[model samples]
Target: MKHIRNFCIIAHIDHGKSTLADRLLEFTSTVSERDAQAQVLDNMDIERERGITIKSHAIQMDYLLDGEKYVLNLIDTPGHVDFSYEVSRSIAACEGALLIVDSTQGIQAQTISNLYKAIEHDLHIIPVMNKMDLPNAMPDEVEDQILELIGGKREDIIHASGKTGMGIENILRAIVHDVPPPVGDSAKPLQCMIFDSVFNSFRGIIAYFKVVNGEIRKGDLVKFMATGKEYHADEVGVLRLEMEPRKMLGAGDVGYIISGIKTSKEVKVGDTITHVKGGCQNRVEGFEEVKPMVFAGVYPIDSDDYEDLRASMEKLQLNDASLTFEPESSAALGFGFRCGFLGMLHMEIIQERLEREFDMNVITTVPNVPYIVHTKKGEQVEVHNPSGLPEQTIIDWIDEPYIHAQIITKSEYIGQIMNLCLTKRGEMVKQEYLTADRVELSYNMPLAEIVFDFYDKLKSISKGYASFDYQPIGFKPAKLIKLDILLNGESVDALSTLIHFDNAQPLGRRMCEKLKELIPRQQFDIAIQAAIGSKIISRETVKAVRKDVTAKCYGGDISRKRKLLEKQKKGKKRMKQVGNVEVPQKAFMAVLKLD
Candidate 1:
């Protein structure tokens, strides 16, 4: 245990965390040259293609230092704010963290947010300036920022280039010398913290955990504290590039357990694992449960695939515990699950994964944040869907969730960033210059405002120089109203949204216009209206695909043509009464893209 080092790499997105991890693995000979690939830790196809890490990957390496062998467990974590939950879990399982900041970009919002988490966990921090090989890299400036953030000496900061493998050895030495060894006793009763889990078709569920106390071995009878379920440890081993079977894993070791549990719910992430006979009295205090920032309905494209979709989500949830869902039925989309996602990107990635990984085609509704509705009857209602909101007559006030958002950007883009945030009803809390050119802007904004396209807009406006991070700051009272989109006279519950009253009419107008373009023209005219109760705020019409009945009577008298046209009009009116409008899948998605 003295020679064991457990640590994770954390940084802002595109800060060379994966590349640095690759170099570490290569330097330690954890992965061979022939088998090595870029972003080796990002095993998912979506992650590789997007050039982003989604899941926190753990791999153990055996490094030889001065003829003495040491065990190094390195966890590569995602850098995006949406996957902060994954970072928190990874931090919990480690004794130290490698805070990698891109020398070219300096410190950003996510870097600060994740650093606080590590500090809270009392983990040792090894600050490293990555991407030193770039011609434009500003190691000195970034080192100063790092020093101010963590308050360490200048020589303590390591300058490393992941591309050229510079400083790799230095980083390794620092891990062994600086990072503290994991503290636990092997003789104590079995106590392991399950940090993550994945589903395997043939092997059942595999859980990745760190042995906090005592030892676990193969064929041991283990019980998961949260679920109160027991299963045989079919296989117990340390994680390398692949699973390596071991006779036993003792305290301070990170490894996996194959318990042959088929259901995903049987093995919960962040649960405590112990031997059945003598287990710890208390559960391991894992990180806080994830609070989803956005909520959307995910329904199978075909109704018959509902059960398949459920199974797919269960398997997906085993890997991504941040995703929360419950069964719900929509009037327009039929049966589906209301899934809570960390953000819009997380929601989009899950939708894509369901289709690509599980072959389950799905439709995702417009995303929204949960609202607290207070009623005259003195009842407080939590409404996730606009359709769930009570009538205006019965409601007293509504409170929407807010977030404390931090954005780091160049001083040149400060005006544009502030403008964008102000337009979203964001109130500026503080603004300060990290350097003469780099500024950090803090704002208190409604979570719903940034749910859709705030991140994308911020990136575009700042020319990708801005990094943003946010945390929920409870709910505040707001002037909110429920906007309902109607086809003819019938309200489509799926199209309803809870929005700020001041922006309701304009947003409603935009939705009506957007829907008119996506909804197909029917045999009769379709009245597309945006309404608040009986008041129609905006309206658009999709003219019917009319057939010229008077075309055949070209030579007839004008009166005869008029008579034919009149009859056709009457027929159209009759058809409109019975014809049911079909809302295409594209229309539902178009609602999210409304600018």
Candidate 2:
């Protein structure tokens, strides 16, 4: 019998997980010399440009070793902390994990985290120390860390340069020896877990499921174990990695299933796919739905793109089950989507793809951390969107989410990093020295303060030599206020916000600068100010320049100025005339740009 091996590649973000995947495809002869590229798993243009894998991708390769053909099913997992939950889910689906530790960097925070998760799952661990070709690679030190930290057998660690294709055979032999074959009764009623889904205008919705047992044909009737909503399979096919698609996927195989499904919400990840024999049995456990930690409203720059923007959101939702969005209306932005994400990277990545992939122009609202507002009536309201806030209700208490952050860096800069964390209202929970040269510092930080550029500040203060990672640490009662911007007594849609007191000052300056950059220049003196109540913390002027009227029109005719103003203000009905000056989009945008 041919052994079925299923495993995923695990590594810290930017530690060459995707790069190593491309090499795996080449060595396995999945892609010939005629067709190959770097980071082949990253199919999206934005993913390639960002040099990160935002989603998990899996591919099956047929390898021949010692005159025996073996099937190698590889899952490439994302490395960013924002997508760590998805990474965990991917790990859950696999029987084993290829723990790729950077030879140069040793074990990073994420490296430890992923390894820990893989261990918890009890998956066979195949430790592969990567980047052996790099100048900083210390294979001996990395091996020691793996053996000491993970306490795995020293011989289990496979030293390889994923970039250069060194020690691949050893890694493969380890998989065959350590990782067990897929286990299940192939003849039982169909039972599989939906790992991902995609939308098809022609076929409706296609779900990717791993068949645990039984067989599902093209006409098999299936139901979502969690929702109990039945769906008929129109096609049961395999995704040949980045190549073409296949017709059928058998037990222990990973593939997509097309069905008469309209909404992706119907076939969610972690849902079970079982044949309708007598009654559904062995239903896969649905993953706990993850609550979004960060949120922002997206509006189209051109109102005409509103429908397109909504459609784009639909497409994104189909592939990414973690994303959350709902229709939203703004006084200035009109109709758009209020989106929720796992974290900042997740938020930014979705926004960037909307503009690049869909080619839709979007003006996004500032990010807001989730909060629990206690009403005067003693009922607690969990606020995910600012628009969802109870406008008329009086809030007696408000609690904001906090994060437990552990920063490991050189001991020489321990005091510097600690001072910076304190300035941001972080409470030191623990601090310890691991060695004479390294220290670990932990803190509980307000989610709002750390939401914007916190990572950047950490790197700047650490002199770029430190490693930073954090996880949610529940909530804390906080004194918070919403800083509203008044544009001539009317609150500007882009200007209103809610911020905790401790972050209001520093965030005010950074936000002001970003607004100014995003906003265009105006024709009149526009006041750009950030404040809480009557206290103005930062101010910048959008000096409205006199409108550029041609000095000469054929023959020194200044009447051209009148015609120019009319032409410039023609399509912009949103413009308001304050005296003889016309306020355009640029002016409103300039105020937002103010530092």
Q: Number of clashing residue pairs in every model?
A: 0, 9
Q: What TM-score fits each model? A: 0.99, 0.87
Q: Candidate 1: TM-score?
A: 0.99
lDDT of 2 by residue, 1-595 (tens): 2477889999887778888788888888887787788888788887888898989987888877778777778889999878887787787678899988888777767787888889888888888889998988888777887886778677778878877898887877888777988777766777888887777778788887788877777777777787788877777776665534555556788777877888656767788888666545667663667778787888888888888888788888878878889888887678888888887788878878887878887777767778898888889998766555665348787899999987878888888888888877899999876555667788999877777667777778878767777888798898887776544334555556677677678766765555554545565545556766677777656555565555445655666677877776662434444433223445443433333
Q: After superposition, how far is residue 347 of candidate 2 from its true place, in Å?
A: 1.8
lDDT of each: 0.93, 0.75
Compose the digit string of candidate 1's lDDT tens values, residues 1-595: 9999999999999999999999999988889999899998899999999999999999999988888899999999999989999999999999899999999999999999999999999999999999998999987889889999999799999999999999999999999999999999999999999999999999999999999999999999999999899988989999999999999999999999998889998878899999999788888896788888899999998999999999999999999999999999999889999999999989989998998989998888889999999999999999998878888999999999999999999999998999999999999999999999999999999999999999999999999999999988999999998899999898898889999989999999999999999999988999999998889999999998978787788695699999988888898889888888988889998899899
Please tell me which predicted candidate would have the highest lDDT against the true structure: 1
Name the runs in model 2 displaced over 4 angstroms. Answer: 65-67, 200-203, 226-232, 242-248, 260-262, 386-393, 505-524, 533-595
Question: Against the hidden true structure, what lDDT does model 2 obtain?
Answer: 0.75
